[model samples]
Target: MKGFAMSTVNIYKEFTDQKVTENVKKVSVIIPNYNYSRFLNERIDSIVHQTYPVHELIILDDCSTDDSRMFIAEKIKTIKDIPIRTVFNETNSGLVFSQWQKGLKEVTGDYFWIAEADDSCDPHFLETLMKPFDDEKVVLSYCDAARIDDDNNVIRENCQDLYNMFDSRHWDKAFVTEGSEEIKKYLSVLNTILNVSGVVWKNIPGLHDIFEEAKNFKVAGDWYIYTKVLEKGSLAFSPKCLNYYRKHTDSVTSSVHCDIEYKEIVSIEEMVAQKYELDMETYRWQRIRRSYMDANVSPEVKKKKIAWVIPYPGKGSGGHRTIIQNVNALIRHGYECDIYSEDDHRTTDEQAAQKIDEFYETCAAFVYVGANPRAEYELCFVTGWQTLEMVRKIPAKQYGYFIQDYEPWFFPMGNEYLIIEDSYRRGYSPITIGRWLANKMETEFHTPAQYFDFCADTKIYHPIEEIEKEDAVCYVWQPEKPRRGSELAFRALKILKAVRPQTKIYLYGSAVDAPVPFEAEKLGIISVQECNELYNKCAAGLCMSASNPSRIPFEMMAAGLPVVELYRENNLFDLPEEGVLLAESSPESIAAALLEVLDNKEMASSMRAFGPQFMKDLPLEKGFAQFIRSVDHLVLHTEYEQPKAEQIYTRAPYKAADEFRAQALDILYTDEVSSTDAAPAVPSLPRRALRKLRRIAGRGVRMIRQRIGKQ
Candidate 1:
């Protein structure tokens, strides 16, 4: 069966944009034939039936003893459309490289394909292969291939993976990149661009010098030529297996010549390392290690691991709970999991494991912050803004983010805010908790986010058997954390109590033993069971989250209670389901909304019923299920360096921190600007505070600089 796929290269330019270079239209096809007269007719037929037009076809015979001379002479008569050229050698050239150099001397075309006489291809081979030349930097482009016997019976369905054994399956996907990047990563160790019969490269001037150099090696001539030509420019790769590579008992490559091929492979790698200025020691070590692993390692015995960088898990922290859940889910999916906490030097791995048992009661592996275990992980999850620093210190093949919330808004618009904001722009794929954060991350920041919506554990937080309501309203209040909007919530509650003097108010989630001109019950942090019971006792509940929709709102809905929240993008985008009331972020708007729920019995009943139904489709396991699926797909399908979109903040201005701080203070304190020619001057932080902030911020700046340098 033949497979077809359009490359990432846009096709309009190749056919209709009229900006296509004339070089792209001119393709010189050189067929080098030996004793394979039986396969010559099939090879010629495949090239003749191409969907894309070719400029010329040259058939060179290397003193073949078979009837190939008579067969080609008769077959050349039926090909009436394209320009044809033929070369017959008086003596056997003995080397295929000689025939190639001979045929290239007589050809004049922008690109060339050495279509071996024993191979066959799909009609779309040239059409797909030539698209990459539209990029002037691409020196070569190639496709995947299938192995067939002399009778055209399939031997191997896809052989590209067999060649790409050191790295992951890079050839299974399509990419267009600079040759230097591809060379240093994948090509430095082995020739992943396999099967010259399935390849095509540009007819650049200096390329012939590399061909002459390749004549030095009898076994790995193609490998030498590919490595040398790539040094000139970029390359394009297609995963479509369109070429048919014939393998027979008498094929030249059938016998193993390990000693010679190994020496040549090392020599070519050394040349590539010097050309790209790669670390010679690292290159040699990696080459030897990869060769060892390729020979000794088996897929069944391979140890797969996933690491997580998280803050120490404490009670009542939703983010920590989410991390534990993710670890448990990954463990269930047959991965050994590791957790690294920040600034924990005292606890050993066993002690950390004991702590996890006390809190989450799971058997997943644990690693202390400074333990520094030795194992190669397939992926690492950077769970917070600070974790990016930890990730910078760790080594992993693939990196991702478990963005629980947008942490930048947690601080005022200052240096800390800008630093936290910069963490999202570090080019890691983010799997956010809700659609609101996902959309915000993807659209505003231009970094794509995979959204995983959450659902509650119905078994734990279910409605009571009998419906009952008390004369009190409850609010999850934490005055110290300003993002909870405690001051605004208090004002709204004061207004709410004045109108309905008979009902009582209850505050929970924090212990604020401060003075207030109100009477209420304050329940300091309660357990999951107690919170569910409190929801059943209250007539209405209020929870405020300015950054992301908190889990408490869903918990309240699950317990069959009506909830009131601020109508912000963070909430509106995620909690569009019924059973919740959204009010503008004002005391008056919130008080009116609470009154509407308490005053009408019919609306209350409908909201209580809508809560459970809205949450039914969202089972508690759905988020983790999606999370594991995303992790698996990203590890197997995506490139090591996933493509990054254009960033939003071009001039982030963090270097001028003092000026930025003063301007931010001006904007925060003063409502209007003065009509003066000079810029307004605001007070800066104290000298001691400035020094401390700089010391903390210096690390982040260096990290950003290092990241930029690598790019």
Candidate 2:
């Protein structure tokens, strides 16, 4: 959208209207206090005034130096309806889960709610939560709780808002799903059950053992407990916000990134996956969880000023859009970023900034058209293959590459290829956009590299309702860029047209080519909004790349469009099978795969449903967080290990030797020209040089493959 504005989600409303006295049985309330004296009185009263009867109330004070113990003692004397018991520990238990275990041991009832001393809930909180335990299989039940401050002002409307990264329709309403399903679908990624103050658990057998295991984790113990406890039975949720989870501003913004806490989080995630035999998406959800964690961390030191030496970009290039998006992300983190473009633009700073705002995002980056920097930068990052040399020439304390692709693959097996490969051997640190690139750098180039997850801006690319569906395929047709497989797509679309002429082909993301060899509509250079519209209406999307996968497939899937791409090593690590079909690298194979999506209604519907679901876990903001952390480590000189990216795909890459031999000749030559025929017309050269260097590559199939094999 030209005038895109981040939509404000104001889900806050006073839900003080509903009342239900639906009672099941005795519910034990545990109040664990430390130094929360001011909130203790309110916390005690919220538990005491529960609409559902409390069989017993246990108050455990962990050596509070404040007036918490005095407030607890005062409240204990006034309690009449519930059996009140108070225990004041002489020494503070190092772990909160220790307090949890002690309180659970003292519970006389079969159900317990651990109400943190700092939190306060509504009068009907217990009654509403207790209603779900009517099913014996329901081991856990919780409701949406809004965030509050010490003044009782709601800071956040609902905890469900945290789940927007993975799911939008869930946790907003009541649900009764199997505990295993909840763990696999929701909790396995990160802790979907956010705050423990909102949950009520049934005291099933072996619950204490889980609690004992939770004691091993200091920060994520509550999250561990939730995953473990859900193994006992089913889960029940209520959307009503009768619980108020308190948050002190000092505690939130003052929080620092704790490495131990993160280790525990991933460790528990691995544990849950192994226990359930779940198909792990490789920390996809944790990217979202880290955003929640990173949001809280207030870096004390200012970030080093950065200069992203970018190539002068055309209006809607995906590469340029990604660079601008990252610049915007850094700006939000208080880093001053400058864009130093080549003099090709021949524009002033104001014009450069205006053009960026027009073409890409509304960037806050200081845009300068020339390579000479007016101001010094602590770090200079290169955004493309063309900028690496320029960035190296620039004076900076640090130089790094924000590589989107193995640029060498964009060229043939010649000087251009060697030049791009040599760029990797440079001393500058590199951060790639996806794991496969990282894998290449680390395994081949032997440089430890970090890569951010490939994700789409879900808010911008998601499915738009009321769009009429069409039997069309939207091809990511970039002609000038040879890696985009212009010739391959032309042949494939021709094959598809011959088989199913009714199927329409829409070419986009590039300028109009002199007339492709098939029946297709050339809708080049569309807006972000228009791209999403194409994604929504089209049955399938084609982004034929022989190098690092572009952001197109992710965007297509984000808009609920099934995608088709070449089956290659570069895509195997990042592209999810649910959203994309990795067709064999041949025109016939590509056409047949496209046909499957167009003709098979069951498969298409399944793909459409799964694409959005897969992307919901990998929204753009999540990718931003991962990138920020990667750079933060670089700038702050922090020690971190980049996770080794491996392929989730098990299927072998399909080899098409005959098709390759023929296509290699097809690309370099024309059909047999007779003596009467003039020289073969040369209009458009190959788009993105084919990574055809494989069986068709050593400069020309067996040669390139032989060289690659030798290397």
Model 1 stretches with alpha carbons more than 4 Å out: 1-300, 344-363, 371-373, 511-517, 638-711
Model 2, 1-711: lDDT tens digits are 011022221212212434444456878889888999887777777777665778798989899998887777777888786788888899999889999999989998989999998887767778888888989899999988777777876677777667777766887679898998888877876777767888998988897888899888878888888888888889999887777877887764224436566567657766875677543232334444644554444333323478999988677688888998888776555466778886675688778778887888677666787778755677889787788667766777788889998889888799989988998898778888989999999899999888899898887899887999999999988787888888777777766765677988888887754556556788879988899999999999999878898999999999999998999999998998877889887665677788878888998999999988999999888889888888888888766676789887666543434554445334433333211123332222333333433234424344543543543
What's the true lDDT of residue 327 in model 2?
A: 83
The parts of candidate 2 lying over 4 Å away from their true place are: 1-303, 653-711
lDDT of 1 by residue, 493-592 (tens): 7556656767788888866555443456778877778888888878889998898888788878888889888877677666644678887675556766
Give me the overall lDDT of model 2.
0.76
In candidate 2, what residue range of length 10 has the lowest lDDT sum? 1-10
